[model samples]
Target chain A: MLLEINDIHVHYGKIAALKGISLEVDEGEIVTLIGANGAGKTTTLKTISGLRPLSAGRITFDGKDISRLAGHKRVLAGIGQSPEGRGIFPGMSVADNLHMGAYARKGDLSKELAEVYELFPRLAERKGQAGGTMSGGEQQMLAIGRALMAKPKVLLLDEPSMGLAPMLVQQIFSIIEKINERGTTVLLVEQNAQQALQIAHRAYVIETGRIVKSAAAVDLLDDPEVRAAYLGGDLGEPESIAADEPAATADGPAKD
Target chain B: MKTNESTRERTNGSPTVTNGRPSFAALTPRARDLAGRLPAALRAPGLPLAFPFAVLGLVADLFRDWWGRQTGYVRWAIYGLLIVGALLLPSEQVGGFMSPYSDWAQLLFFPIGGYILLAIGLNVVVGQAGLLDLGYVAFFAIGGYTMAVFGTKFGWSFWEILVLGVLLSALSGVILGAPTLRLRGDYLAIVTLGFGEIIRIAARNTDYIGGPNGISGIPHPPTLSEWTVPESEPFTTLGLAGIAPLKYGALDGRPYYYLMLAAIVVTIIFVKRLESSRVGRAWASIREDEDAAELMGVPTFKFKLAAFAIGAAIGGAAGVIYGSQATSIIPRNYEFIISATILAAVVLGGSGNLPGVMLGAFLVAWIPERIRGLQEYRILVFGGVLVLLMIFRPEGLLPSRRRKAELAEGTGGMGSLGAEVGGPTTHAAAEVGK
Candidate 1:
């Protein structure tokens, strides 16, 4: 495994958020953790990024124990997070915001900036505009592009489509897939389960900070139990689906 | 029926209005209109001050243009001209009030230099780093005391003692900042304020630095005028108009004024460079949102401490200058109000932008001297002006566009973790930004 979490526990104060939760993300795989709000999806990503320390766990990224590393050090070690609500530096120009994302980067970023501009031409069009002035879609694009500027080995995307329109959601997910295709592994935390499972190579179902199920994305999509709880179904799972599918298979609504 | 009766009952229980009238809120806009007229009238008397300021503005603009292009030679030429002009201006005892030279220099210029330096230093800590440090005078006191102790106790030369003062103040800044700076901003401010008060109280009670009596006869910096040009005939033959030779033993304020002027200019250059570097960017990010900045890989605490240390050193350098000029240092010389005045300078000038802060320092330092006719009412008027300024333009006279936008976006550093969905958010890791 490229990124391994072994029985990591986390606490806020007196209350435990993650109770010995373990998961894995191998190289070149788009692994997703899907759950309802507060199900520890964000916490898990926070743990991986070293934003929250592990109470009782070992996180080995690239086979090196990194649970004790600092948050920014984690970024330098190649974990980038496009946080929930799109944490864009509102005070900075779009170009400056992108430059901030590459804080951990040590070399020339003209090529990287060009790549990001090519990826999201909207950012390039108004590189001088402040991040706060951008539309939600554009800000989301900036957030993702910023994370990409770090040239991360593994990108952790937290709720990348939280408030986006359906069309933008599709566009964002496709860009995420493209990002994965560019040789970076992705650990995606999402509320849109069906769509996330559709693009993910593997999926984990978390409930109230505990993992309930783990399986191949297609298998999870095809599993009746997962279908009933997360895939919006209560009956038959008729069709085997392609892994790269953007839309969930119309296996039709379950008949009670 | 019951609800209506109860409403009538409440009104019946009350006294009748002799004259029912509109509330204050209703009259607010009209009150505002009346208040608005007061400013133009109040500003009318200050119009005489405007002519000089307008000339100052024009000169500042030309210099700023040269500064932007980094035309050092032209800028230095202007500075050299200024130094010559400052040197030539006779003290009040020599020329009196009508000489177009304010004798105010002997009384006000020295302290003004100290205040400006303090403002410039505090700008690095509070404005650029977005750290609200109310006890910044603590650093200033440490700088002053460093000079006082070293100068009096060791009989050190002013030049060598200045280096120690700056180093000691920087050391104190790190000592104070490293541990407490990680606290949330308001708490940090309170701690710094407490620390400032502590330093004053400590200085007041401590016999080592001379308790409340303070240290006197701190040595002046060795003069170069006679040393370099010598009061000899060759110097007289050089015959630079309005240029007076520096004298060390005589306690002339003009030479020291030039020295302090040089100090401020050098500080401006240093701060401007730091404001453009990666560390500056890191400070910007941390000020905006610590968590987001950390995720982006800007080490917040290390940089905040760096700001404190640098600011401390600058303040210390100024303190040493003050000590040498006043030829004394006392606990009472450092006060909470001094800290507030310096902060006001940063706020009025433009926090985060150097030119604005410099302008702020000038305004803050000049306000008292210009309004000395008002005597006891002077500070009250100054307070009112600041209030009016903040009401109209809180971002200071020349606001930094970057900081203005940042403020508009909310003074960041808000962390949201835990909602059952997100968890309770111990924040044990990143909030401290260790």
Candidate 2:
């Protein structure tokens, strides 16, 4: 396993955001965690990133415990997260924001910047523009590109498809697949479970503060129980499955 | 529970589960690292920056004064022109002509010079770093009192006491910053205000520094003993053509003016260089967005402490100058009003701009003293003008380009070309357009 979260618990004051839940991500895999709002998807990501402290249990990355590491140190240790809300430094230029991403690294950043530009051509065109001014899909692309600039071993993407049109969503998913193919591991959190699972190697369905189901992407896609409960209905019929697949890729449908 | 429910309802249309599985498998590990490249020497261009110019200007001014004494021609010419102008003008206008030349030396020397130094220090904390210190006066008081207590009680030389004063003020700054930095924004302001009041009250109540009566009998700075000429004759009385007596006291205002001028120049250079360096950029980034700065790998606490310490040290230097010039120091002298006056200069001058702060300091200090005929009414007028200025031109007379851009972007108004380059559209796109 590249990363192991051993039954970690986190809290906001008296309220527990993450209960004792454990999971693992091996190298060279796309793992998706799907849940409804406030099911602690963002909290789980935040804890792994060290933005939030774990109240109990441990988080180990690459055989080293990092439960007490600061957020920036975790970044240096190769744990990068594009936070929920695409927390781009709005005051900075698009190029400057990307520069900030590579802040922990020491070397010529132009090569990295050029690589990010190659990944997102729109970002390249708007390099001099402020990060705050870009379109939603473009900003999302920039955010991912920025995280990529850090050259992390694994990328933590929190709702990358959020607020993006279905076309942009497909584009983002393809980019994620391309990124994964390029030798970086990926841990994805999403509301668009059907699509997320479509690309993910393995997946976990979370409810409240615990994992309800864990399976391979294709198995989960076909699972009647998962469809009925969280995937928006039965995927048993070929016609319904085809319809669901198109809906997942259609423009603006998956935005909500 | 009710608030949480309401917040949940407002956010996603339902009260969803607050806790869920802790999934490390789902944790993405793409690190948003700050690419530590070469220092920003390339990013921020221009040689020597603002500080060197200020130093050069000080040096040139000092050289001009020294040159004026050697030939006596410039001094005589200045007096001749003044007299000529006075004679040429009507009696009422003669006063106006003389006014510019009248007290020009003092105007250039004391309050303006002192206030500029104070404002620059305050600017470091409140403007460049966004710490919003209201009790910055406490540092000033500490600096002044350090000089007063040591200089008067121990009969320490003025220059030595000045050094001590700076060190003590810096120490005081660190002590204050260490505890108060945990508080943010308005809370920090209130805490600092209380701290300033505490310092003032303590000074007033303390007996070692003479309490309410304060310290007196402070001596002037010592003369350079190496340069020997004749005895019991004024230095000014000596002609440049022949070697004459060296009377140290006669050199008085000229030397003091030049010394203070040199101090201001040094401070300006230090601050300007600091602003453009790695440290300066870090401070600016923190000022703009602290959490972002911290996430970007800046040690926020250390930088903030440094800002406070540097500011306090400058204030201490000013205190030394103030003490030596007055030959006395009192608790009343370092009062709340002095703090307010310094703040007013900083605000009115355009917070981070050195020249603007100097101009502000000059206006605040000199205007009141100049209008001493108005006495108590001067303060009322000052307050009224401040209010009017705030209402009419809140950016002060000369705001920094970044500040102007910020204001323009914030208010959704057109500013200069640079401001218009990145306006409210960017902000809107970031927050709501998504």
Number of the top-ranking candidate, with DockQ as the measure: 1
User: Which regions of candidate 1 are displaced past 4 Å?
Assistant: A218-256, B1-103, B227-245, B249-251, B412-434
Error of 1 at A49 (Å): 1.7
Tell me candidate 1's interface RMSD. Answer: 11.6
lDDT of candidate model 1 versus the reference = 0.74
Worst 10 residues of 1 chain A by lDDT: A247-256
- DockQ of each candidate's interface versus the true one? 0.25, 0.13
Q: Report the C-alpha lDDT of model 2 over B1-434, residue by residue, as the tens digit.
A: 33443344233321221232122221121000001111345213322232333333234334444543676677668656754442222222322433343353344446666787888888888767777777888887887777777776787887788888889999999999999886666677778888889998898899987888878866666665535334443422331112221222432343455566668768877998999877786776566555445555566778889999999999889888777766677777776777778888877776766666777787787776666567789778877767645533455655554554334333211111122223222332222212
Worst 10 residues of 2 chain B by lDDT: B29-38
- Clashes in model 1: which pairs? A12-B426, A37-B421, A38-B420, A38-B421, A38-B422, B418-B423
